[model samples]
Target chain A: MLGKVNHIAIAVPDLVQATAAYRDTLGARVSQSQALPEHGVTVVFVELPNTKVELLEPLGADSPIAAFLAKNPDGGMHHICYEVEDILDARDQLKAAGARVLGNGEPKIGAHGKPVLFLHPKDFFGTLIELEQL
Target chain B: MLGKVNHIAIAVPDLVQATAAYRDTLGARVSQSQALPEHGVTVVFVELPNTKVELLEPLGADSPIAAFLAKNPDGGMHHICYEVEDILDARDQLKAAGARVLGNGEPKIGAHGKPVLFLHPKDFFGTLIELEQL
Candidate 1:
């Protein structure tokens, strides 16, 4: 059902600034930073012992984060990622339980080459959820 | 700075049904369930590898979750809990970064004897964030 918390995503207008803010204020360092043009954003990760905080900054106007920020510019959380043992099984289970699946009907390689699936926010409330298999 | 992810909270209306849904769908079991009268809600946690999914249900008319669910009843996510080395230090850091603090100016004993603090949702876009230290 649930395995681990892979990451917590925080939407930001600027990754560099946010990363610096996190570092200077909390001593948390960015372990990795990369741009996912496909997702229209650049993400910087602050790794912790068991979880990581992901800073997501929009790369372009059409990016999802940009649209989200337009609606709520203060920048909020994007999604909660859960590490699952079997993603397909979990997706099926969620579907059977009346939750809508936003995945491409299959698992795909996501950031860090992990298999991932996204559930529609409409079904989960207003929060988007990502399921990743480690 | 940061230690781990204490939990990933999900807001649901019916804990028993959601718990059953998660268990049957993913083989994930509820590690613990309790009601926080102060918070006016009941929480059920599904343990995972590095994190957990907390299902929250409103307990009364003035409950926070009840208001949240009223806006989005399908039930999505609530907040992301991060494990920190020091709650006060984390709060100060976030405050220094111009983030608003929602705690009562001190860490309080939370579920399982952990010290917890909350940050204001206005500063975090619309997402409520909880900081906990083990």
Candidate 2:
């Protein structure tokens, strides 16, 4: 069970190129752009009517996004992030349901400075999912 | 470059069980339910404010959804469907941009009897994206 989708993260090779493609081709505009060194990625936010599209580009060769791009060269949709009320409670419930937590068993700063934690894709499915608590 | 998110499709092992979980745990009501044999799947629609969530479960053992569920047992988000104006035009543009089309290069009956086409996830990272024309 999840709430409103906070954002859909798309992994790209280059933020500038991907942002421009979404902007020029799709008419989606960048509302915000920030680099999260902790995650080893840079993100550009495209504000949609009700949902936002997040463009993520790996900052370094060692970045996880880079590996994902290597595995999937077309650079498509990455993860679906759902907004939650309490990060801890959600994490506990998910863990109880056998979902593996990727973070340090605690909420960490995410893109846009929101508290977030990632659930291992192996535990949920092939899809990588993020739980964000604003 | 996109409009509002039409719906987020999640692949589950059992539609009834998944729908019940989303309803009981997340309070999401099932707005619609249907079986699309062409797609070899059954779908349950959960209405959100601006975007809806589609729960997908394979109809048979040979169904594609079943293969996906086998690859990732936990069952999670599948595809991010974007509402498009013209399915044919969208497919043409996507092909021009080097994206692979999964369908017979034509829109067919989708969940809720809407015309839709699927873009090969291999063409756009690992995410299977669907373009639905309402």
Candidate 3:
């Protein structure tokens, strides 16, 4: 079963401008930015009392967010992550229920250093979902 | 100041299929479907322990989701909502900081029966954000 939302990620064309909107304008506390080359993204976490919002930008031309940014240009809400008790159990349950898990069907260490897996958008009505084990 | 996230909205083409996937497959508790004609959309709320996911489908051909669906046939994540303690203060602060509040910059009663307003996607890194007064 899914727990509370872990973080909602937004694919942004410019991370600085995007992060400023939350940090400078909204006055929300934000975490230091981290670049994850493995994921091909530069991430910044905006802290909220209840949950977090992750801002992601393409690390390079070959980055996956590049494709998304190409279509959106201005960037947009990319995906949402929900917490689960067990990554393997959640994956198995989701797979049995006909949901397609992304990657090699195994959970990888996400930005939070937790095992996370992405679900196919098609199976989720076109919304890409990430399951993070807490 | 923004409170916890209230809900993330997804524009769906088929409410029945979308709601069923969440209810049957994901096992998330869902609320009864409600159609808001003035907004020209039908909405359903998927209850998560910490937050909610709202699914929106065009009530008719003229519905707002119709245009979005035309662009994205599979449906997709539409917008995300953040709870604010005082909407007027939040709106003014956001406006002063140069954020574009969608529509007439006036809050409307959303499906949750709370005052809500949408921020333009352009000003917020292409993510349409909803500010809700809790």
Specify the highest-lDDT model's number: 3
Clashes of 3: 1
Model 1 misplacement above 4 A: A89-98, B89-99, B122-127
C-alpha TM-score for every candidate: 0.84, 0.79, 0.94
Residue-level lDDT of model 2, residues A57-110, one tens digit each, is 888557768877887676866787888888889888877766688957888887
Against the correct fold, how does model 1 do in TM-score?
Answer: 0.84
- Which runs in model 3 stand beyond 4 Å of their true positions? none
Best by TM-score: 3
Highest DockQ model number: 3
Please give me the DockQ of candidate 2 compared with the native complex: 0.42
For residue B59, model 3's alpha carbon misses the true position, in angstroms, by 1.2
- Per-prediction fnat values? 0.70, 0.48, 0.77
Q: Residues A18-118, candidate 1, lDDT per residue (tens digit)? A: 77866765567685678888778899888777788888888865786787788767777788787888888888888877788784668888776888998
Worst 10 residues of 3 chain B by lDDT: B59-68
Of 2 and 3, the candidate ahead on DockQ is 3
DockQ of the candidate models in sequence: 0.53, 0.42, 0.77
The docking category that best describes candidate 3 is medium
> For model 1, which pairs clash?
A1-B26, A3-B49, A124-B75, A124-B76, A125-B75, A125-B76
